[model samples]
Target: MAIRVQLTERQAAAREEYESFTRQAVAPHADAWDRAERLPEEFLEEFAARGLLGAAVPAGYGGAELDPITFGLLNEELGRGCSSVRSLVTVHGMASYAVARWGGDRQREHWLPRFATGGAIGAFALTEPGAGSDVKALRTTARRTDDGFRLTGQKRWITFGQRADVYLLFARLDGREAAFLVPRDAPGLTVRPVTGMLGTKASMLAELSLVDCLVAPEALLGRPGFGLAAVAASALELGRYSVAWGCVGLAQACLDASLDHADRRETFGVRLRDHQLVQRMIADMATGTAAARLLCQQAGWLRQDRSTESLHATWLAKYHASRTAFRSASDAVQVHGAQGCGDGHPVQRYLRDAKVMEIIEGSTELQQTTIAESAYHSRTRTTPTERVTA
Candidate 1:
């Protein structure tokens, strides 16, 4: 069964605005950007100019402050243009929201305006070579100094690492975890791009190195020991939501591309769309795209309450959307046959990007574990009356 989302008039308008912008600004240039393996920094400024950089940030801070549904639509539209562009919005939104939620007033005053306006791009650093899914295994350390604190660590797979003006870095301090706002030009810090990625090639992924990176005590966000699962909880939820919507967009892109190809391309003296097998593939792609979109909308709606149930819904949304994107991209390639395999084909990029979506934020394997654990606990737990009934 499939679900449908009922959008407000305002949300509908917002969605159209974003879709038009993507068609005009991003879609035309996506293939070239992918080939170049880099999106020019000027593009980010353009996004900011259009109020797409900080969708969730408050108006007072120079943000659009769009509601959750509108924000999800924005991601979906951008994803249709290219996953690389969607990735930038996801990371930027994550950092902006995190600061608003956990940073001190001074920190917010200092960073939000810049982040909202694209004056300072933000990167989140958590994953390390030794630790990817296992947050506890992270070895980055933050030592308290008389002046403030000194951070020493190496972070890998950080999106936008090479271009970010600041990093919301996670590290352990005095055997407890915490978050620090580390500037890009901080002393003893380095960011080097990870060349030749399999997907999101133009996202500017990089490795971050910090040796005795120092910051004022006020740079610490939230309470002590607020890192990993604690400080990152809200950010992770937002990331998953954004990724889910992006997947929906990817699936839709695949369906649209497949349909267009089928209508125009001929085989065996008939149009490709006239073939029974090709029709099946197109049907599946369209169905999956619609289903994935509904699931994303469900998660976006649940997010407003910020309840435990909402978290589970987001996980399920991400899991389903990622899988659907991969399937749709594969079918799209098959439909295109040789055309899809070419370097310049958009379907090829979609296939590569869909694979990466499954691994980022949280792997498909990790999502399975979390979702099942939650499901099992919910089913097995017995209330007083339920226990008697059983």
Candidate 2:
């Protein structure tokens, strides 16, 4: 946690500001929000007005347009306070990034301003009941029609779906994968709220049903067959980067909580921190948090460089950071003993939300494979002689 990522004075100031905001606006309410399973409508508006919801869009669109490192700081601090609030930032940025990169003029013009100005909340609707990590296996279909396309399918596990004003939905269009911008009020679209999750219960999750939903031709993002390879690929890459930083924040939070509890609690006439067992957990939590933060910063550097290697770096960061966050949360609960599992305890909530971090953006197992596969591919790109010379 002592390791700091190099930042400009402005960025450093921004990070401090984010920290102050989180301490004031998020930390105190996090547990209650989790129990309630929904954030107040006013909070969303304030979040958007503060430019957090549109952190990735261009300034012309009324967004803050933060760089990757700066954006990571924002996510990290917010994640430290409450992952459900951080979830909104991640998904909204993903959707904004997609439109900025892949959307046609009309699509961008129609959506980016609203998204950037807090006039709309955006969600990515790529996951299906059977296609959690398999983007290509989505069952949603968009049949080409005289006017535009007829969309019919279901999207499950959509974060902020219950309140999203727009969705960047993926479907098979004329037998090839495509992306479409579907407004919430589109004809034949239904949103069903989902609750009682293992974690992130306050994320406002929902299942979207598009029964013959219709969008004009302008709704299409890129050309047919480019959905998964380009739009979704780009979005998910940024997503991994954001989630990795968020996990770093979560880990740090757990470590801080554990440290405070050990200092304040005693057993058998000795402070908890005086016990070797508690000290060991604290040491592990601190080390893991530092390592995860470093990895996330490395990925952020690659992202800012616009390097091709950024994607794999993100895989590595996400894989390690998520595991560290979960492990840290588990130890935090252990340090608190029975009290940690009860109501009004933040550690209990952290434990649950950390589990969701390991699952979303990409599961821990999924990231391991992606990193290994990418490593082999990079190695194979060099000839045998070049490899040996290297």
Candidate 3:
């Protein structure tokens, strides 16, 4: 489906450029990357050279400084080709944005250029064995030392962890959350790859072990006691936007595949597209795709404008789009019959990828709880004057 919202000429041009690049350079390699279970280093170099790797970083820091909505559009186009590639953008952008927003001038001057140029890869280390969604429950700790801090903990499910040059690692400092920029070469640091993920094989996932790793005072990002909140505020908004767009892309792909299969496949006497049930399924897919795209775009716009409802809108978009993607992909597979189950067919891959979208970043159940809580609080809250009067 075509985008319906108004776009600035520059945004339109950027989208066109991104779409062309993805179709030519990214889409053709998706199947091979999936089969290999690794993102090609060449792809990274190419992305950097094209300024796609750090498109959202500020211009002074060697980035394109594109607005968040444009970044979201770029992500959607890339996701249409390969979700794994889009995952790279999500993690990298999140790390860079976190530093830019909270890092000291010295930190920004030292790190932003390398990060934007792809001379350094950044990974956020937050998830742990004992703590997935509960930030306060994290066990990683950093103790004060003579000139710095000593960190010790295990971080799990870190994207790009194995090869990242720097890490935005989160740990507790004096009973408060803090973020540190831990170099990959930091002494006593170890990274182990995790395998068998259902999708996004091209993006590496690793477990990190920090055994008394030392970080200088300069390594700390922002003020102490704000790491968890900062990361959550930034990552959630960006993650929700990226994944919601991704789900729209997945739904569109499913709809296209299902339509192609239905139009060509023949039954006992006629083509599958001629059947009433097949038509109904295609109609459902199209409707879902349109709805998902609209919701995603609305969220993106709200985020770009920094609207008061941005948080709730983002959660709503992500929750609905992910469910729509999964349902559409499943229907696409059914439309393809046995061929959809084969490794050679793309529909099966879409199905697998769509299922992964439902679980990663934040689960559907989590989104539901967030939305409900937000709505509940919004309904019950009163102004200070109202409370006093009551």
Cα lDDT tens digits for candidate 1, 229-263: 56688887888899999999998999999999999
Error of 3 at 314 (Å): 1.0
Model 3 per-residue lDDT tens digits across residues 146-232: 978899999998877766888988899889988899999888798898877788777788999999998888998876775558665
Error of 1 at 109 (Å): 0.5
TM-score versus the correct structure, for each prediction: 0.95, 0.96, 0.92
Extract clashing residue pairs from model 3. none
- Per-residue lDDT tens digits of candidate 2, residues 130-166? 9989877879999988998889999998999999999
Superposed model 3: Cα runs more than 4 Å off: 1-4, 378-390
Q: Is candidate 1 or candidate 2 better by lDDT?
A: 2
Please identify which of the two predictions, 1 or 3, would achieve the higher lDDT against the true structure. 1
Evaluate candidate 1 by giving its C-alpha RMSD to the native, one decimal.
2.5
Query: RMSD to native for every prediction?
Result: 2.5, 2.5, 4.0
Summing lDDT over every window of 10 consecutive residues in candidate 3, give the lowest-scoring window.
1-10
Candidate 2: misplaced stretches above 4 Å? 1-4, 378-390
Full-model lDDT for every candidate: 0.88, 0.90, 0.83
